[model samples]
Target: MAPIELKELKDQLQELLERGFIRLSVSPWGAQVLFVKKKDGSMRLCIDYRELNKITIRNCYPLPRIDDLFDQLQGAMHFFKIDLRSGYNQLRVKEQDISKTAFRTRYGHYEFLVMPFGLTNAPAEKLYAKFSMCEFWLSSVAFLGHIVSAEGITMDPAKVEAITKWPRMTSVTEVRSFLGLAGYYRRFVKVSHVWPYP
Candidate 1:
């Protein structure tokens, strides 16, 4: 990891520790944490649970589609998007399953007391809990990259412009990363802005 990212991780972990989001643990299963840069220029820590997810049973519950979610807001004059900071931290992992979510960092081994990002079923499990009583409401506040408002959804010009400045993708990973951001806001801008979607 870059020095800056390592610093960010340390800071994040410190806050999590203070809030009891995680606890030191020794477990048979452990995943390494991965970090990504957010558009806000912040680091988001994720556990690479790919291997674990492969063996875990998938949740049958499906999250409502974002487009469908948006449709529900039509003709509505009000919209309130609550930004939940460390929102997942508010969710408690079942005691028995907490061990399964254990992760190791250079600093120490820890397991989440709350939901951690990257679990395949996490979105499904927390969808209703996070959004309940909150439709026209949202879980994470940022939908498809645009911040929702009572005035309705609108894209930030800086973000729309940044998409134009990204270099051409050279790999599948790069393509996924680009699409994950651009695809969510495709209707906000021209499809051509993020061409060659796979």
Candidate 2:
């Protein structure tokens, strides 16, 4: 907290670097130095960054329209849903924008290998690209009853096949928990379809 103590800490950090106990990831915003370990696996130094995230640009992206999604599902009997793994992380920030993504943790300040959730332009740009890709896939397979919310409802095997082809969705869960208006039409699904039959 004192100026002399701070100077001493920095000098110690420099000594650690000189002794091969850390590595640095250079960015235009600031330099992030990381601690390294020796073959014995003991921590050899400390890293810290409380100054970076404060200056990083904040992110804002519009949420996709839900009604537009429902419109895509006009007619279908079965539905399969897909969710992306670390979807935001799948995108790469512009090289110049990387420094803006730096965050300080107890260990050290680190930039993301992919776009992080905290950036001003990240959400809009990333979502736009993702939705645009979905729209393109929908348009290309117009006959598959319109992708309808990155989730789809259709009895068509072709639609199931298409949904399965998506990058992350490998298995389709087929236990119906809610039937909506269609429940009234089925006279026998074992009991009053309005309530749990079991």
* Model 1 ranges off by over 4 Å: 123-142, 145-198
Number of colliding residue pairs in model 2: 5
Model 2: lDDT of residue 62: 59
Give Cα-based local distance difference scores for all models. 0.76, 0.44
lDDT of 2 by residue, 1-198 (tens): 445445554675565346443334455444343444545773332323335545655555555564555565555444443335445656766666555555433334445546544344445333333333233323123332333333443334454454446353233332242233234224323456355332
TM-score to native of every candidate shown: 0.66, 0.32
lDDT of 1 by residue, 113-195 (tens): 88988887775234334444344533224465565555676776667787789898889998888777777677865555545
Off by over 4 Å in 2: 1-64, 118-198
Model 2 is weakest, by summed lDDT over 10 consecutive residues, at 173-182
Error of 1 at 178 (Å): 7.2
lDDT score, candidate 2: 0.44
RMSD for each model, in Å, please?
Answer: 5.7, 15.2
